[model samples]
Structures are given as structure tokens and as C-alpha cells.
Target: MFRSIVKQKIPFLDLKIQHQQIKNEIFQAFEKVYENTSFSGGAFVEEFEKDFAEFCRTDYAIGVNNGTSALHLAMIALGIGEGDEVIIPANTFIATAWGVSYTGAKPVFVDCTADTWQIDPSKVEEKITPATKAIIGVHLYGQPFDVEGVSSICKRHKLFLLEDAAQAQGAKYENIPVGGFGEMGCFSFYPGKNLGACGEAGGITTNNKDYYNELQRLRNHGCKERYYHDILGYNMRMGGLEAASLGVKIKYLQGWNQRRKEIAKKYHNGINNPAIKMQSQPDWADSVYHLFVIVTKNRENLMEYLNKQNIFPGLHYPVPCHLQKAYTHLGYKKGDCLNAEYLSNHCLSLPMYSELTDENVEYIIEVLNAYDDE
Candidate 1:
């Protein structure tokens, strides 16, 4: 048996180790930006944009202040405004809905699939109305939603398709990168994301030249030129320091993602507890395993047990967006998005990071298996 009293604490995530591995490269990136004095948005940001665009296999990429800004700008660029409606997964982080709400559009929430914990494409159409102008398919927890299923509906209904890839930097759907699959893909490079920057940062990817140009203007005060303003816009440009740091980090993203997958595999195969349920990976999804979420009716008990053993897990979201107080005005009741509400109450994320050792993974699995669900 493992030690009854453990001294090692397994955190839900540890960015410090990740930072340590790439410290020299990140510092060099910072030094270059500092020397250039392009503090706001300049060459460093531009270089990262180009590299990121290439990585996602998109023709163009636009860096923004943060992921929320990226989503808001993408919606605005799509002409979503007051009286318009957007379809999004109720299971997602509130930011996904915020993007639509910020654009003065109503966010219609859809339930998630029971197994994959993704937006259930089958349930999306029922929520669509004449006001529906777009659908934001979130690649929640780094697993791409059913792109083909959702895109088919979008095409049939003449609605814009946006990819919310905040947790899916290196993820793919059907062997193709995510961002390019939709009209526009929004990514967050927050300090905790798979390809996180040193600070808040985000990027948009698209193959549509027109949307790309409009997004560029929208993020930079609606100006193509320094002093000329083309349209009313917000000051949401990404910082040079964040961009430089992101550029350096992006180089290691694929490797880090691979390691995350390896750890997830260990958890998947080792956790034999019948009371615990894991998210299912469809054959079409090449997830980066941003968060290895598991569901259990006895979540609070399990959490307390893990805490005693110095193993701490986290909740992706303890509340579903449709049922949140902020969206109460939307008039959605508890059972409106059934699967999402169910998962919200039951799901807890395990410790998932590239920095975790094989022994760390085995220990986590063992602890989980030993948990008393009753």
C-alpha cells in the first residue's frame, strides 16, 4: 500500500514546472521584445500571429487582448448584434456565452453528449430560431465537437460556424486542425491553457480573407493605418511581451500535448472504479487532453478523500451556464439543458499536465481506484 500519510501534494495543475522547462527560451523571447521596445503590439506579436496561423493551418491569424475579446470580436465581425441569436453549448465556460452576449445577441444553450461531454449536435437545431445567425461549437476540454455534424446544420440554415478552441490549441477533428474548420476559430492563451502565454493573450484563425481583414481592424481600434479609423472598434490588441512568450511556448506545445495524452491514457486504463465515469474520446477527435474530467455522484466525498491524501482535483464548472444567475433573465430552468446540468453537478477534473511524472499518474489512478464512492 502507498504511504498512509503522504507528504507529496499533487496539484491539479503546475505551470511552474512547464515554465522551468522553457525558461531560457521564454527569457530570450522577452529580451528580444524588450530590446525592440515594441511593448504594445509590434513585430513580436506579428511574428507570433504568423507562426500561430501556420500552426493552425489557417491563412490568417489575428492576435487579441484575450480569449473573451477574441470571441467578441469574431461575433462582431460576423455582424451579430441586438436581436440576433447564437447557439452554444451550455456545458462550456461562461466566456463562450459571454462572447455572444457582449455582441448584444442572445446565446441559446444546447445540451452536451452524455459520453463525449461535447455540444450535442442533435439537440442544437431545436434551439435555433429565425434570429439565430451563428453557432459557436466549443471544443470543450480540448476535445473537438462534432464539426461535420454541426457544420452541416450551419450550412443548411445559413448560419456562421465559429470554433471555440480555448482548450484545444493542438487538438484536431478528423485529422485536420480545429481553427480552420469553422468560419473563425477563437483561442485563449491564458497562462493555464495548453499553449498559454506568460499573460493574457488570444488569437483568431480564419481562411476567409474578408473576415480576417475585418477582425484585424476590429481588434486595433478599427484602423488599418496608424491614425485612420475605419469603424467603431475597441482597443483589444495583444501585448508584445505576451506574444513573444507565446511564440516560444508554441514551439513546445505539440510535445506537451503528447505528454498530456499519455497521462490521460494512464488514467483511462488504470481507473477501474465502477462509480467513476470518464469522458469518451471519439475516433474523430485527436484531443490534447487539456483536462481529464471524470464524473461521479459522490464528487464531494471523493474530493475530500483526495485532499486528505495530498491529491487535489478541480471542477471545470460546478454550475452550468444556462442555470447561472447571470443568465436567469434568459428564463432557462434547471432541466432545460439536461446533460449539461447533469455533468456540471457531477464532473471533476483530474490532475492533468505535461509536467506530471509517470509515477504521479500511477499514484493518482491508484488513489482514484481506492476511493469509496458510497
Candidate 2:
């Protein structure tokens, strides 16, 4: 008689497990928001903004509806507009480019570092031009980029520096948090992020009071007082419910990030396949491992094999921004950003979350090792 083997199914991200862990806290926060009818920006949002600002070690934080809105407002507040060019790494999510586009600015693409998957600071200077106005350094996969190099370049060139810190919440470089390193640091609190809210939410951290006040106005229809407008702005204010939930989650971010680090360490030490290339972590970076990605020439085959075993994974980005159809008018071709293009094809995100179990990690490692043998 032949016996049937049942493979254990592992999800790429298990938000349900995380929710279960904080169910009561999330419920109570929602209850408070409902009771007070503070649906729009209110005390809940204000409290979270202050708490998050302290967490990022910044003097102020302004909450917005989403990360894209945060980036857009930051660009607008910094005076990035038509005829301006902003340099961004090509390997990041398309929203980074969208932010620049929303401000009527051109997004100049730069290739990421092959090992770190971050914006190559060495390649940045060559891209700077007379029209260049700002540089948005993205902390991809929760790892902080080379802040000192980028900061120095920004200082020398007299360009504004922004941190697209969507994936990096608790990450640090040189023992300092990433969000406070630049003029403005943007964050996303999507349900899956390191410091997630119940729904969509984002915020910006800054030490400059002027920028902080300007962002607050930009997010609230350009109104410092009721029925008064200084500049045309979007209604991009964050909701009270999302802020309340985020306030609860913020208290647990460090612990959750630590758990993610432990999981990443296990993957790094156990997955000994020569064909698989792991991301290099610099000594100065303390990454939170948002999505533990591995690069392999046989990515498609490996992904298929893992799926058959009921172990689902994900792709951070399968297509670089330059090659996306939406950006075709930018006149970029396939090889314009070679490193980012290569990473888009080779990268594969493993199942990584704070709730991922030890048994699952072992099973994944075993399956990967078996695939290497095959």
C-alpha cells in the first residue's frame, strides 16, 4: 500500500496570528475611537504622532493617510515641483516614484548595490545634475542604507535628503534610528509592516519645526485655521482608528522586530546553499528583516518547488521601476539599471514574520537544502 504524505502549509505572512496576540488591545483602541467619534484626525492620532516621534527620536511627527501621501507631502513641503529631478533607487516599490511624480518632479533612477540591495552612494554623484533637487534613499527590506555617505553627498551638493523608510521602523545605522537621519523620514504602517496599524497609516518624522508645520498643513487641505487656505493641499489626514491601533502596536515594535531578527539569523546560518546569495548586512546597520529575501539563479524553479510543498513565499518586486510599463515614457530601457534588473529576476522573499514558528523554519531550511541537492 502506498502512503500519502501531507505537507504542512506555511503562509508567506500570517497577520491573523499577530492579530490574535494583540486582539484585546486592538479592540479596546477601536472602542475608544468609536466612543469618542474621533473618526478623523483627533486626540488618538495626536497621541500616536507624539509617541512615534519619540520612538524615531525626532522632534515632531505628522500622521498621514498612507506612506505615499507622506512621501508626496514631504516632496511638496521641500519645494520639489515641476522641472525638478529627484534621484531614487530603481529597486524600490513603485510608490517611491509615484511620490515624485505627484509633485510634478522627475524621478531619476539609480542602480542599487548588488550586495546590500540599497541605493549605491558611489553611483549617486554621477546622476546629480543642474536640475537635481533631492535624493530619496530607501531603506529596503528593513535595512538602513549608507546614511553617512548619502548625507555627505547631499551636503556637498546642496540637495535635500529624504528617507523612504517604509520597511524600516526599528532599524538603525551607527546605533541611531534611520528615520531621524534625514530632513524627513517617511514610514508606512500597512497591516504587514514591522509597526503595523489595523489599516492604512503613515507618518513623517523631522527635527525641523517649520517642515513639521508645513506637513501638517499640507495633509489637512492647507488649513492652519478653519476655512483658511495658505496653499492648495490634499485631504490626506490619517484616521483616528488607524492611529489608535498603531499606538498599541508601537509599544510592541521592538519585541516583534527582535523576533524577526532571530528568525533571519536562523535562515542565514542554516540555509547553506551555495547557489543562494544572501543579502549582506553591514556592521553599521541593524536591520529588522522585514522580508528575508534570497537570490538564486534558479528562482522560478525554487519558487515552484516551494509552492508544491505548500510553503508559499512572495516576491518583493519582480520588475524594476524603469522597466515597468507606467514608466516607459521616461525613456528607460531594460539595461538602464542593470543591478536592479538582475535583482528583480533573481530575488525571492521567504516566509518571514514575527509569528513564524521554529518548526516551520526548520522545514523550510530542509526543503531548500533538498532542492540544492537535487
Candidate 3:
């Protein structure tokens, strides 16, 4: 007699569970926004900006519409424009490059390190030319990149250094927060981010008063005062509702990040598959594990097997930005970024969230260890 196997359904990320945990506080924040009618950038946005600045240990924070807008404003404030070249990791999201492109600058691609899957600082100098204006180091999947090496390169080359801390809200390197390491760090408050808002939101952290003031104007049609436009800009201001939601979520960020770390530890200890290659975390990095990625040559089969077991996973990016159809004009070929191309083919993101239970993690690990190429 044949018997049916029972499968436990696991989601890649369960935002509903997280919402239920903080539903009361979130609703109360919404009520306050309603009472004040602070729909545009107002007191709510200002309060969250203050809180986020203190949280990131920076002198100033300016909230914007989204991470892309934040990056765009940063590029403008730093005086990057047409004919300028900005170096960025080839494996990162296209938004990083989009920010540079929006400012009429070309994005120069650099290969990522194999072990850390971060921008290879050793390859940076070779890409620099007279047009090189900045170097963007992305803290991919919550792990802080080699800030020291990248910062040294920036200093020696007299280029601006920017940190794309979109995936690493509470992560740290050498005990300093990731957002405070560069001249300006950009953060995303997308619904799935560590410190997410109800809707889209983003911000920038900087110690330079002039940069801060310029960013403030840039996000609001370049208006320092009502009816006074100082420079041409976009309507990239953050809404009060999103700001209020973020305010409520920020208070729980540290604890949530700690929980995520605990979950990552369990995944590290439980999944002992020879085919799986986990990301390496450096001693100086305290990653929040936004997405627990595993690399395997048999990614397609593994994803299929997990689906059969009712477990869903994800791919951080199946296509590297350099090889995307949108960037064909840049004249990049398949072999331009070897490590990033390798990663794009093999990387798989497992279920990772603060709300995931031990039972869920163990079951997922068991299934992963049980996968067979046959």
C-alpha cells in the first residue's frame, strides 16, 4: 500500500505575522496622522527623521520618497552629473545604477569578491578614470562590505564614497553602524526592509550640514522657502503616513534584527549539505541577515524540490545588472563580471524573517539536506 507524505507549507517571508505583532501600535500611529492631517511632509516626517538620525548615529537624516530617490538626491548633492563615472558593484540591484543614470552619469561596473559577495575593492582603482566621481559600496543581504578598503580607495583617488545601506538597516562593521560609515548612506524603507514602513519610504544620513540642507531642498522641488525654488528638483518628499508607520517600526528594529541573527545561526548550524555554500560573514561584520542565501550549482533542481515539499524560496537576483537587457548600450559582455555572473546563476534565498519559528527553520533545513541530484 502506498502512503501520502505530509508536507509543511512555509512561506519565503511572512509579513502578515509581523504586522499582527505590531498591529495596535501601527493603528495608533495611523490615528495620529488622521487627527493632525499631516498628509504631506510635516511634523510626523520630521519626528521620524530625528529618530532615524539618532538611531543611525549621524548628524542629519532627510526622508525621501524611496531608496532610488534618496540615491538620486545624493548624487545631485555631491555634484555628480553628465560625463561623470560612478563605480558600483555589478551584482547589486539596478536601482544603484539607475541613480547614477538619472543624474546623467555613467555607472562603471566592478566585480564582486567571491567570498563576501561584495564590491572587490582591489578591482576599483583599475576602473577609475578622470571621469570617476564616486564609488558606491552596497551592503548586500545585510552584510557590511569591506568599508576600510573601499574608503581607502576613495580617499586616495579623491572620490566620493557612498554606502547603499538599503538591505542593512541595523547591521554594523567594526562596531559602527553601516549607515554612518560613508559621506552619505542611503537607506530604503520598502515594506520588506528591516526598518520598513507601511508604504514606500527612504532616507539619507550625513554629517555635512551643507549636504543635508541641499538634500532637504532637493527632495522638495529645491524649495528652501515657500514659492522660492533655488534649484531644479523632483517631488520626492516622504508622506506623513509612511513616516508615522516607520516611526512605530523603528522602535522595534534592534530587537527584530537580533531575532533575525538568531534565525541565521540556526540555519547555519542545521543545514550541513555539501552542495550548499552559505555566505561567509567576516568577524567585523554583524549582519542582520535580511535574506539567508545559499549557493549551489543545482539551484534549479533545488528550487523545484523545495516547491514539492511546500517550501517556497527566492532568488535575490537571477540577472546581474551589467547583463540586463536595459544596459546593452553600455557594451558589457557576459564575462565582464565573472563572480557576479556566477552568483546570479547559483544564488538562492531561503526563508528568512524575524517571525520564522524554530520548527519552520529545522524543517526547511531537513528538506535542504535531503535534496538529491538524482
Q: What's the CA error at residue 136 for candidate 2, in Å? A: 0.3
Off by over 4 Å in 2: 1-6
TM-score of each: 0.98, 0.97, 0.98
Using TM-score as the measure, the top candidate is: 1
Q: TM-score order of candidates, best first?
A: 1, 3, 2
Error of 3 at 230 (Å): 0.9
Q: Can you list the residue pairs that collide in candidate 2? A: none
- Judge candidate 2 against the unseen true structure and give its global Cα lDDT, from 0 to 1: 0.92
Q: Residues 28-55, candidate 3: write the lDDT tens digits.
A: 9999999999988999999999999999
Q: Model 2: per-residue lDDT, tens digit, 1-374?
A: 11223356898898999899899999999999999999999999999999999999999999999999999999999999999999999999999999999988999999999899999999999999999999999999999999998999999999999999999998999999989888899999988899988889999999999999999889998999978998997899999999999999999999999999999999999898788889999999999999898999888899998898778998989999888899889999988889999999998999999989888887888777667524
RMSD of 3: 1.9
